[model samples]
Target: MKNLAESVNIEAAEIMKIFQWKGTTDQLTDEEKTHLKYEIADTLIYLFYMCDQLKIDPVDVMKAKLEYNKGRHWKKDKE
Candidate 1:
């Protein structure tokens, strides 16, 4: 497997190709989906790096956000 930086570069190129070939955003081909998978993976890799730099745990942050959202949607007994 390639390193995160390498993946990011690959993803960037694929993104450009996506825009160039599939001008219309309404639909995408199988090739586009493949490109998108790489893009998402690249984004996640970058996000993890950022989290590391900031001294934050991505897993914890995600868990906190999920818990917060769950509480927000919870109904009160009085309702």
Candidate 2:
């Protein structure tokens, strides 16, 4: 779980680069874009490995969560 969480954190940091740039991902350099791609892949790899160890189907769980979320009422933040 720790490894999976850490990988997600690293991916989040990479994603934040887009917001930090004050523009879209296209504003990032080619190398930065590739690095973000790798970070996302690393997070997915960790998630799948953890799910495999627990004998869980990642896709099934994700589908279930999506269904659950569909029933949820989210309050939009005041702008």
Candidate 3:
């Protein structure tokens, strides 16, 4: 299996391509959707590696961030 950093880098590159190809209508081509999946996977791979390096658990961090954001109750204000 490929290592985490390599996987993340590969996915990050795909994300760049997606940005380059995005449509104005908020619709995505099938290939773009597939690339998006890879982009998310790549980000997760990097997050996991960073957590491991810091001796942290991914789930714990995720839960903590979720709780923090929930408490903040962020929303977009309409103009």
Candidate 4:
């Protein structure tokens, strides 16, 4: 479980490289775009694996969370 969570975060960080966070770089190259695709897939794969390993129903959890969020009052702060 811990490994999967770590993998998900690592892959997300890898994907973030394409976006030039904190003025680090320019746009993604063709190769970096390809890497972005793979990283996103990796994140999802780890997430699915973790859910299966925990015997958790992702669909149900997602729905429940969505419903719960729908009932909550919220606002996005101005940037």
Best by TM-score: 4
lDDT per residue for candidate 2 within 1-36, as digits (tens), equals 787778767777767764574654346678778877
The TM-score between candidate 1 and the true structure equals: 0.56
Using TM-score, rank the candidates from best to worst.
4, 2, 3, 1
lDDT of 1 by residue, 1-79 (tens): 2465665576677667766755464687787788788787777877677677678899999999998887574567448
Per-residue lDDT of candidate 4, residues 59-79 (tens digit): 999999999998777766332
Candidate 3 lDDT over residue span 1-79, tens digit each: 2566677777777787787855677778798798789788878878688678879998988899998887564456322
**What lDDT score goes with residue 13 in model 2?**
75
Report lDDT per candidate.
0.73, 0.77, 0.76, 0.83
Better of 1 and 4 by lDDT: 4
Give the per-residue Cα lDDT of candidate 3 at 15: 80
- Judged by whole-model lDDT over C-alpha atoms, candidate 1 comes out at 0.73
Model 2 ranges off by over 4 Å: 1-26, 77-79
By summed lDDT, the worst window of 10 consecutive residues in model 2 runs over 17-26
Please provide TM-scores, in order, for all candidate models, with all chains considered together.
0.56, 0.68, 0.64, 0.70
**Highest-lDDT candidate:** 4
